[model samples]
Target: MSNIQAMIVNVRVDNLEASLPLYKELAGDVEVMRFPYEDMNLALVGPFLLISGPHEKHISQHATILVESLPLVVDALAKAGAEIVDEPSEVPNGTRLVARHPDGAVFEYLQPRA
Candidate 1:
């Protein structure tokens, strides 16, 4: 079904050190992912993901969906009236595209590098 793989709900926090402990308590023994594009850190705690970084106008809390095929999904989404916010670009371990659906919901789609 649409080749959707995994979904990560990203939460933007003001301080990483302050919030990390709480998340660690909730989801013990988890690994954290660091992003180079921005001063951001991500931790997968249970079914939730915590993304902490400085408060910036361009950075907002959003959900990321991993897909099998980026171009296919992008084309389909565009046909469905989704406004592409960021074009497909290389990230740390994959390519990411940001878009907003017609319902005013924004999401980031990721396709891991092959």
Candidate 2:
């Protein structure tokens, strides 16, 4: 049996305002809530995950999410004007897509193996 559980993942960012738009597109139809934090913000997407503000300290490094389709996401992100840092790569584990937001935050989109 798999010991998997559902919870929320919080990713800290530098600018919440600028980052929310990009995250909104990725979240698709998922309902999201945003909480402003003086200098940063926290975006909650159900019980799945949350993307915080895009601050200087929070830029460059962040967490990742596993999606079912990498190619589709890549295309969508491209259309949204996201900068592709690493193209889709298929490894033994799964496929990975990397990108950087306008504020220089690195994002990893992973499609886990079966």
Candidate 3:
């Protein structure tokens, strides 16, 4: 079985503050993990990952998945004929890579920094 840790739904918004309250409420008032990546601002509230910024800077990934091992996930994705949308790179919280599966579903896989 895949060593998937947690999966976060990706949500895009024009204004982070305006959209946060609703997501925060739905997430049971969880603490938010906020960070900046490139030209975008991201926030993690429980299972919801909110991203706000220019639309051009955002990739249409279906979800952000927290994984145990990014390298392992990369190897598995290669064997599964998935296309690497973004190479593994350091983000605020960890390293991440975006991949498009054979069926055309795109996802972001993240491995938190040790």
Candidate 4:
């Protein structure tokens, strides 16, 4: 069975609060998970991961994938010839790592805290 949990698209915004109403309306008023990471403010609004902050500090990953295990993801990515852009580390959400696939697509794999 695949360990992938959920995939979220990353949307960069200049202002999180201003960008949220549209997403919230689209998602039918789903609760937003808001938090801060480094200098960035992040909010999970439905399937969209809204990010607002300095562009330089951002990882520039195309998307975020929630996984069951970061270790397994690391091993699989390594075998698949994916470059580890960022080492596995605990973030505000959980443990995560950024990787660039062989096709040059970047993704953030996160294992949410239990």
Compute each candidate's TM-score over C-alphas.
Answer: 0.81, 0.45, 0.93, 0.94
**Residue 54 displacement in candidate 4 (angstroms):** 0.4
Tens digit of per-residue lDDT, candidate 4, span 1-114: 889999999999999989999999987868899998888889999999898989885568899999998989988998999999999899977999999999999999999999
Cα lDDT listed for each candidate: 0.76, 0.62, 0.91, 0.91
TM-score of 4: 0.94
- Please name the candidate that would achieve the greatest TM-score relative to the true structure: 4
Per-residue lDDT tens digits for candidate 3, residues 1-114, read: 777999999999989999988988889958999998788888988999889888785579999999999989988998999999899998878999999999999999999988
Tens-digit per-residue lDDT, 1-114, candidate 1: 768988887766677667777877776777755454566676566546677655564535368888999989888897999988888898887999899888888888889888
Off by over 4 Å in 2: 1-60
Name the candidate, 1 or 2, with the larger lDDT value: 1
Deviation of model 3 at 45, angstroms: 1.0
* TM-score of model 1 vs. true structure: 0.81
Candidate 2 vs candidate 4: the TM-score winner is 4
Q: Rank the candidates by lDDT, best first.
A: 4, 3, 1, 2
Candidate number that wins on lDDT, 1 or 4: 4
